[model samples]
Target: MGLSSRSVFGLVVSVGLAGAVGAQVTLPPPAPRPEMPEYVPPSQRVDEEEPAFDPSSVEFDPIWTLDEDGKVVGPDGLAEIAALRHNPLITEDLFPIIETILEDRAKEMDTKVFVYPRKAIDALTGAIDNFDVRKEDTRNVMGEIANSLNVSEGLVSWLRDQGLITEEMSMVSFNIMQDYTKRTMDQIAASMPDADQLDLISHQSRFLVRLGLQEPLSAFGRLSRKVLELHPDVVENAAELLELKGRDFLDEVAKALKPLDDDQLKALFKEAYESLHGPVVNSADTDEKIEGKPVGDR
Candidate 1:
C-alpha cells in the first residue's frame, strides 16, 4: 500500500529530528604541537661550525648605465629597469597567482570561522535540548551564532527606540525577527520528546497560518515530496538507521559506503525505480513534436 500523508509527515519529521540531534555531537579539540628547540647565538652555538667565506671566488654583477637619463643599458636592461620600477616580476606575473592563493586561504579561514561557531551552537542547543542545560547556555549559543554571522540581536529594540523608521528598516528588522523565530523553533523542536512532536508541529502550523505563510509551507512540502520521490530508499534507510543506531550510524554508514564500487552503487540506485524512462527525444530527431504533431505521426 502507498504511504499515507500522515506517514510522510512523520518520516520527514523523523529525519529532521535525527539531524537536530546529530548536530549536537561534539568533536574533540585538536592536540597541541610539540615546541621547537630554543635558538642559540652563532658565537655560543654548539651544534655545528660556520663555513669560511672565499673572497677570491666572489663575483660582482653590477648594474650598467651610460650616465644619460640615469637609464640602465645592457642586455635586457630596459626589462630589468622596468622590473625594478614596477616590480613586474612579482606584480604583473606572480601577483595573480599570489592573490588567488591568498583568496583561497581566506575562504578556508572564513569557512572555519563560520563552521566552528555553528558547531558550538549545535552542541549547545543539543545540550539544552537533551541534557536539560540552563536557559543561559541557550542565550550564549544564540549570541555566538549572531556574532559569527556578524548580526546584532539588539537591532529590534534599537529600531523600536528610533520612534520613526523607514519601511526598509522595518523590513530588515522583521527579517531578523523571522530568522530568530525559526532558530528558536528548531531549538524547541530539538528539545521536545517524541510525544511532544505533534504538539510542536501543531504550534508551528498555527504560527505559519497566522503569518499567512501556509502557502510557502505547502510549496516546501511539495518540493520535499519531489525530492523523496527521486531518492526514496536513501531517505528511508538513513532515517531507519539513525533511529536504530543513534548518532554513530552515520560514521558506520560512511565506512560501509566507502567499499561499494561505482557500478555496484549504480545498480543499487537503479533498483529503486521499477522501470527507467527512455532517452528524451532531441529537437533535431523530429520537428513533429515541436510542431504539435501527434506521437503516432512521428
Candidate 2:
C-alpha cells in the first residue's frame, strides 16, 4: 500500500506478538540509479567522437516499484524515507539540496493561516488515512479547507461525513471562525450609510495591519481604542463581546501568529524534515496518478 500520515509509523517488536500493535505496513529493496555528472556540454561531446565512457562510480539508491496487480514490489519509497528518519547513511556529503521550488505554494495550500472559518484547517488536522494517488485525495481534502474559509458551504455536509474535522479541533477552529465573523461584521458595519463609522471600522483593519511593525503590547490597547473610535460599532455590544470573551482572544492570536511568515515556516519545515529524515529529495521524480495513468513529474 502507498503511504499516508495514518500508516506512516511502525517500529516495534512483539511480546506474545508482544511488541507494538498499530496500523502499519512495508515493502522490497530499491534499484541502483546512474551517477549524475558534474557538468557536460553539447558541443564538447560531439567533437570528441569518443564514447564518453565514465570511470568514476558511486553507490546508487534503488528505485521503489509496484506491480500490475497493485502489489508493492520494491522497498516502499515512503518506507525508505521513513527509515531514513533514524538512518545514518543520509548525510550532508551525500544529500544537501532540499526546498520547495514554489514559494507561493503556501498561499495556495489550505493551511491555517490562509484558511478561513477555520473548520477546514481543523479537518485536515484530524485526518489519518491511507492515501491513494489515483484519487488524489490530499489535494481534495485541503481544498475543502480552502472552500470553508472562502464561505463556500457546498462541502459542509461532506466535511462532516468524512470526519475531516474532529470534535476537539472543530472547537479550536471556532476561534478562527469567530474571528472571521467579527471581521465580516466589521465590514458590514463599515458599509453602512454612516461615513464616519465606515472610516472608523476601516481604521481598525489598518491598525491591525500596522500592529506587525509595532513592538508587542507597547501601544496595542491605544491603537485598538483608536480603531474602535473610528468604527465604534465593534464596541457597540461591548457588554456582549465582553461576555463572549472574544476580545482578548483575538488580540492574543494576532500577536502569536503575526510574526510567522511563510518563508520562515517553509525553511523551518524543510529543516526539521531533513534533521529527522535524512534529506528531502526535492526535484526528484514524483509519481502522480493523472487520469488513472501513472506518470512521473518534477
Candidate 3:
C-alpha cells in the first residue's frame, strides 16, 4: 500500500545523511579543460598581422604657417622656436645664419637714427604744452617721448636703476633726448621778446653742455641755471628743483653718470659719439714751430 507522510520524510532525511557522510561523487573531470591555442610570437602571427603603415593615411602639420602678408600666424611657430632654447645643440649650427640676419636688421634700424630729430620735434610740438618741467613728472614726460620714439623707457632707465651707467645708455633715447632738449630750449628762447639775444646767449655760452660733459653730477645744476636764466619770472631758486623728490629725468641721468669714473665716462662718451657720428677724424699733421714762429719762417 501507499507510504505514510512521516515515514516518507524519515526515509528522505536518511538518504541525504548517507550521501553527506561518505558518498563518493565524480564531476566528470571538469569537461577536459579545453586546450588553449599554442602561443605565437607577433612576427609569426598571420591572422592578426598589423595593418601596413600608409604615408597617404597619415596627416602632417606644417612647422610654419604664414598669413597672406607672409608673417607667421600662430603660436605653433613660436613654440617651435622657444623649444630650441633648451636643445642648444640643435641651434649651434644655426648661429651663423642667425647672426647674418641680425646684422642686416641692425643696419636697417641704424638708418632710422637720422630721422630722430625731426620725429622728436614733431612729438614735442604735440605734447610739450601740457608738460611741466618743474615737477618730478618730467620723467613721465620723457617716458612719453620715449614711447613716441619707440625707444623703450625700461631700457633707458636700466642704467639708472642698476647704477651701471658705465655700460651704456640707449642710443635711440640718447639721440632723441639730445634733439628734444635742443628743441625745448629753442621754444623757451622763442617765447621771449628778445629771442635773438637769448639764442645768442645760449649759443655763445655752452657752459652747461661743457659742465655736463665734464661732470655729470653737476649736469642738473647746469639745467637749473639755464632754466632760471631763461625764465627768471617763472623759477624761484635752483634749490627749488631739489624739492622734486631728489629725482627727475635729468636727475636720473646725472645720477647714472655718478657711478662711472672719468676714464669709463670718456670711453662711454667716445663710443656713443662714434655710434652717432662715424669714427673721429685724425687732425692733419702740423709742422713744428719755434718760439711762436712758423716753421717756414724759422
Query: Lowest lDDT 10-mer window, candidate 1?
Result: 213-222
lDDT, candidate 2, equals 0.32
Per-prediction CA RMSD (Å)? 38.8, 32.8, 29.0
Pairing residues by index, what is the TM-score of model 3? Answer: 0.19
lDDT of 1 by residue, 3-106 (tens): 99999999999998899788996658999988988998888977567654332232223333234554333222121222222321123554454444434333
lDDT tens digits by residue: candidate 3, 5-35: 9999999999987896676764455567778
- Computed on alpha carbons, the lDDT of every model, listed in order, comes to 0.37, 0.32, 0.37
Worst 10 residues of 3 by lDDT: 283-292
| Model 1 misplaced regions, further than 4 Å | 1-150, 153-169, 172-298
Task: Point out where model 2 deviates above 4 Å.
Answer: 1-156, 159-247, 267-298
Candidate 3, RMSD to the unseen true structure? 29.0
